[model samples]
Structure formats: structure tokens, C-alpha cells
Target: MTGMRILAVAGGYPGWRAQALRALAAGWPPDAVTWTESDALPASAAGQMTLDYAPAPPAQTCAVAEPAAPVPAAPVRISRDFAALLQHAALYRSTQRWALLYRALWRWQNGDRSVASAADHDGARLHAMAKAVRRARHDMIAYVRFQQRAGGGMPEYLAWYEPGHDVLASAAEHFARRMGKSSWWIGTPHGSALWDGQAMHLSGLPADPAAMPATADQVEPLWLAYYQSIFNPARLNEAALVQHMPVRFWKGLPEGPLIPAMIAQARAGARRVGQAAAVGEMPGKPVPMEAGRAQPPRALPSTLDQCRRCELWRHATQAVPGCGPQGARIMLVGEQPGDQEDLAGQPFIGPAGQVLDDALRRAELARETVYLTNAVKHFKWVARGKRRMHKTPGQREVEACAAWLEEEIARVKPRVIVALGATALRAVLRRAAALQDHLDAPVLRGDALVMATYHPSYALRVQGVRTPAQVAAHIAETLARARQLAEATLPA
Candidate 1:
């Protein structure tokens, strides 16, 4: 241990520090190397290596009459996934994080190829620490509320945050990208980041929280008023609200204090609405059908529009019903409608639908020959500015809408059903199951052959990692397999 060399770094620069790790691993034994980013190094350290933040000097090569045989470089292999994890874990506050990452990397470089598995203790520890760092970065980005200076020169904004990890440097990039051409400063317990319209600078020393303004801004009241208006009395989930926006962040947020009062008002308003409904004096237009009552049979799409089985109907414009031949051999069930589908009152009409259409064409399956429907009838969404972003429906909501789906299934009587995503898979199976488990494989559920496949929307979400053509190929393959299964189940 006394013979080992120590490498001192300025912490938070994982990429530069990684170069040192690679150099050490290629030169010395793992046990004979010590990496430190602390303020002071051990007194007994035999040798020292300092990692400079600035660009390094170009290497100078000198000719030697008898060049010593180059020491064989130790085999060091790191996967892109593991490298990303190590970079994230470097921001963790744990003192042993550097050692842990090195040990994992060493094991990976050695014969142990399973070093990246979560089942391995070191790998699991690294993942957990990386997860914490990632969460802290997310929290910093979400909770850091910038307040404008009273008498601003070039319009400066300031915010004070207390992140659980060393994430100020990592999270600063997000603010820089989001608030382009605007100057802002975010101070944390560990450090501070300053953005000046053009560039971002990170200071290693902690900034005094007192420097931030404590007074409320003029826009806060308007924000609170808007929050109150949008706070749905019908859906009051305090536990969920607190989980997403933790109590620890309440101090920094402007609408924090108003939450309690808003919840109270929401409860009271819900009670009033309940009382009004009980007396048949509803707040809005009365729903044609009673809540939770079994819907009556009507062989028309207009009747499905009058459904009130779930709260989804209250928010969505209309119920998006299945379309195609009534007795088609194949039925494709998607999770739910999107903004386009909700507006059009039809299934598979959004960007996801376009992808599905392309895949169907590639699979040689005629669009008119197959039935298209959704597991859930209505489009569930949360408003973001003017956009209605899609929201996954809860299991309870899925169950509530199951009756309509069952009606469609009975009407269609398709020999083969394709569940397009986890939500649709759960709906069709009547039990929770992973999409990967049944993909491209048919499972006979009584008389119908049910197959699972990635949803078109999922392909859209993963398009950055996987090309659109690749995703379409996968969807096409799944559909082709489903068509073959359908034909096999048909009467010979």
C-alpha cells in the first residue's frame, strides 16, 4: 500500500479522470493504484499525478538509440453502458465511489465478463449510486426556480438549491439549453453554476444561500391562481403529488405554501360537486349514463360516445372506437388514443398510427382486412402549455373501460389478437405480463390466439436509439408472425 502511487483530481470531471484510470490500469497493478479527488492526499504516497482541467500539452517523442521494449498494455475493455454508469456514479457523494467504480472496471477488464450484471454486488452498488446521482440531477433541474433580480442589468436570474448529490455541474447543462440567451446563476451547497447567455462556468466552492433573494416575485401570485384553477377536484391524489414533488423541495418552489390551501379548497369543491350531483343539479352537463353502471347494448358508435364508465370520458373529447370489418380475422389492440385519435374519434390515426400503417403495409397485411381498436377508449393526458401530453392510464381506469373492449371483442370475434404494448397486453390477458415475454409468440387464450408486440408509440420513443426503419422492420416481423398464426388457427 505504501508503494502505491496516488492520482489527485479536481473531482466531477469523469472523462478526464477516466483517462488517468486507463493509464494506471495499463501500467500498474490495480492494488498498487490509489485515486483521490479529496482536498489532501495521504502523506505516505510514493508518487503523485495531478489531472489538470485545461487542455494537456502535446506529447513530445524523442528518438532513443536502444528503445526499451514497450511494456505490454494490460487488456482493458469497457462497454459503453458500463462507462455511462461509471460517469454518473462519479457524481455520487460517497467517499468510496471512485474505488468502487475502479474495482468494477478492473473486474470487467479481467476475466469476469459478468461484472456489469446487477446480480453482482459491485455492479449493483455502482448502479444504485448512479441512480441517486441521476435522481439528484433531475431534482435540481425540476426544483430550481429562478427569480428575476429587482433592478437587473442585462436581466439576471438567481436560484438557490440543496441537491443531495454533486450534480450542479451535470444539471447546469439542462438550464443552459433551456434558458438560451438568458443569464442565470444556480447556487448549491456543493458548488455553483453561472450561465452568461453564451457560456457556462462551474465553481468548485459552495455559494452562500443568503445571496439569493427571499422575496416573492410578481408572477408567483398569477402562477398560484393558475395552479388553483387547474387543480382538479375530481382527482385529488396527495400521496402521488408529494411523491413527484417531494416535501424537501417545497421551500424553493413558489406554489409550495399554496398547496395545503389548494388541497383544502379542492376537497371542499369536490364535496360541493358531489352534493350537487346527488341532488341531480350537476355542475356541468349531465352524463347520459349513471357512473359505474353497466353500459346498455347499442349497435352504434354514437352510443359508445355517451359512455361514462370512467373519469377519462370527462377529460377526453370523445371515445375513440375500433374501425374495420366487424368479423375481421385479426384485431390490433393499442394502449389508448393520442391527441390526433381523440380529435378524430378513431383508433390508429396519429404518428404512432402512421408507423403502424407503414408496418402493416410492409407485413403484406391489408389495412381494411384487420380490425383496429384500443384497450382504453379515451385519450388520457396532462396539459403541458398548449400541448396535451399522453398519460398512461391506471389499472383501475383500464378495468373500468374493459366492458367496452369486451363488447368490441364480442362484435369482432377476431381469431387472432395483437396486443401492441404492455397496457394492451394487460387488457387482453386480464393479467399483468411483460411485453418481451410474449413478443412474436402466440399464446392461445381459449379460442383466440393472442400475440404481443412493441407499440408504435414505443418505437417513436426509442427512435433516437433505433432507426425508424429498424423499428418498422421489427413491427413488420411481429405482424407477419401474427398473420401466420391467424391463418393457422383458421378452419382448414
Candidate 2:
């Protein structure tokens, strides 16, 4: 019989007749017959068979049935003398023959005339071959790739690639369990894996490309939409994208629709980026100076009133403005809005202020003798259940609150300013200094001497770890020195 020969291959367990294989078979000669097996076969004509025609089976074991008679079980026959001898032996011949033989012949090339070595070698080889076959079969199932196609009101993936192993059955089950209602197909050079939303099936490869289904319509469009949305024009890396998502994947994606638009945007974006870099490289123009360089008058006030900017105004009973005689010798600055300060709307009324007040009393300084105000005018807090927890204001918030502090500074015009911790230091001086660098040391801001020290809250938190009494004594000593400086510089 003369006809175009066709070979069908598959992975995992076989399924019903392959639809693609049947479609491809229609145009072939009448004498052609399909043979399904777990072996790879090459295309060849009887007379024109070439070197490629001799295809070896894939490195896998196949369960094939050939008509043959079943062998009957035979009874074991043993001599009474041999049986008695074996019973008294240290090792049984059935389980421990190899051990017995090895022990019996320990000499060099000990020619003990028994088929034991040959039998053992054969057994070992058989075991290895079986293991290889099983592994190859498994790999064949796992590595197959399938293309997606649309049919019967559902979308599916259908493509053919020669799998190097048997991984399809498990792969199908994984997807089936995860997406129970979805239908998909995986076609391998050997076979195809099909999931009809309920169960999976494996079958033979098709001969013709036309027999395969068309590409899915919805898949391409959805893919392209997602790709475009995530394409970040600001950081579009063409090389990186191509490296991660290769050209091969583009054929299966909606990338074609976005390619031209992306290219145009990328070029424009690159030019703008370059221009900005050039501008940044150029030196900034200097502004003309007006006056000591002319000093603006400070609009300092002695009391908190008519203050409204943040949400703090809504909750705080009153605005806790600065308190002190105008032109007081010493000015003290602190963080804003303690619980009591928020309620009283006054600075130096909270526990830390109470601590300061007590320290001042012990140091023999009058409570109303020095300038007292917060670095920030308003309270900044976040809601936590029923309580409002204080949140440090951001840089912009600090800048907004600076006007009130500046007013206080203008009114007081003290000879010395005492910044209580990092926050106070930044608010008063308009710059942040490292605690380690400026602790105990004062930074001069124009004519005013700015002294730095730990905030009362820091001392309070570490009370158990270190003695609060010692901390209070240290603060008193710093204040005493500040008082002396104030008296010497602005004797009142």
C-alpha cells in the first residue's frame, strides 16, 4: 500500500482519537494507517527513506499491549539434600546469594563458576534503564507549550511543542484546581493536554498546521491593554522590557497596537529629560541685596491670640501664645501641643513645662522672668481610637507655623535662646543640627546665643533606664549658665 505516512505522539495517559491528527489524515493516501505509541518517529517514504527516517524511541518506557499468551505459574522443585544444606547455611540463597558469593571468593580473580556476577550486573543495568525511562516520560509531560485559540464561546490555549518529559497530567490538575471553570489546551510534539473545564485529556499530535485552531481574540486585546497601562512613560526601558518579555511573546500579545505610540512618546520624553539635566548643570543667578543687609523688624507678640491655620485651632481650647515681658533677657523654645497645652492652649503648662517650672524654682529663677513659647503655634495630631496621638509636623507644616514663632522672637528680642531638643532647635534656628554635634554646645544666631539641651520628654521616656532626678539636675545647671549669660548680655 502506498500513502503519505503520518505519526502521532502524546504525553501522560492517552485519550480518544486526536482531532488534529484525523483532520491532517483526510488528504493523505487511502492506505495510510495511524499508529499511536510513546516513541518519537521521523517522516520518511518507503523507497526514499533517509538517515533521519530511523527515529529511535523517546527515552521513556511505554505501556503497549501486544497479543501473547500468558505464562503459567510453575511450582518450585528442590532436592531434600540441597534444602537441608540451605537451612543450615548462614545466608539464604534467595535473598543473600550475592553476599554469600562475595564472602566465599575474596581472592584476586577468584573464578567461582557461578552466574551470580553476571546476574547482578544485569539486574543493576535493568534498574537504571527503568529509572531513566520513568524520568524521561515525566519530563516529556512537563515541558510542552501550547498556543491559545478561541472556539465554542470559550477561549483556550492550543499550540504544539515537543516536550522533553511527562509533566502534563500534574500541570493540568494544578490549573484545574485553581481555575475550575476555565478551559485550556496544551499541544506537544508528542501529544496534547486538554481541559474541558471539568477533566483533562491527553492525545496525539496533529500533522498539519491548518488543523490547529485559530489564535484567541480576547487574549490579545486584554494583554495589550494591561501592557499599555503599566508602560510607565517616565521610565520606559525598551531594552529591559524586550529582555524580560521577548519578541516571541509579542506575537501572542496586543503589543503591536501600542508599539508606535510608545516609540513616539519615548523619544519626546528622552529630549525633555536631557534638557532638564542641562538646566540643572548651569549655575544659578544671584539675587541683589537690599540692606545689614536692611534688617526687617520682628513682629513679636507677648500673648497668643487670633491664631488659626491648622486643625489644632478646632480642638485646642485656646491658642497658647508666648508668655513673658517684652525684651526678656532669656527665651525658651519647645515642641508644640502637649495634652495639657492642647487643653489649656498654652505652652509650658504640660508635664514637660511643669518639670521646667520645678527646675526653675529649684534654681532660684522666677517662673514669669523668662520668655516661654512653642516652636509651632498649632497642635498636630493623628486620631488613635479615642485618644489623639501627637504627630510631628512635616517640613511644610513647620514652615507654615514659623510666622507665629518669628513674631514671638521679634517681640522678645532676648539676649539668649534656649532650644529644648532637636525639634525646638530646628524651629527657632530654621535649620536642623545633629544632636551629637550640638548637644551641650550652643550655636550663635546673629546676636542671640542659642543653647541646646535634651527635651523634657526625652528625659521622661528614659526615666526608668536613667535617673530623671539626674536629668533634671543637669537641665537646671544648663539653665543656670543660660541665666548668667542673659544677665551679663542684657542686664535688666
Give per-model CA RMSD: 23.2, 24.1
- Please give the TM-score that candidate 1 achieves against the real structure: 0.48
In terms of TM-score, the best-performing candidate is 1
Per-residue lDDT of candidate 2, residues 1-492 (tens digit): 223333343322122123222212222212233333324344443343211111423312211222132222332233454333222231111223222322222211123323122245533333343344455444433333345564544436554544333444445566567657677666544456668887777675543435657665544444453465455455666788666544444443346547657768768775466466457668978777786564565454344443434445555445567788888988888877676666554577767887898778776778788988877776777789988777776667666578888877887888889887778888888986765566678778877888877777666766465688877887787788888888885423
Q: Each model's TM-score, in the order given?
A: 0.48, 0.37
lDDT for each candidate structure = 0.77, 0.56
Clashes of each: 0, 24
Q: Which stretches of candidate 1 lie over 4 Å from their true place?
A: 1-7, 15-35, 40-77, 212-216, 262-492
TM-score of 2: 0.37
Clashing pairs in 1: none
For residue 39, model 1's alpha carbon misses the true position, in angstroms, by 2.0
Q: After superposing candidate 2, which stretches have Cα over 4 Å from the reference?
A: 1-311, 463-465, 490-492
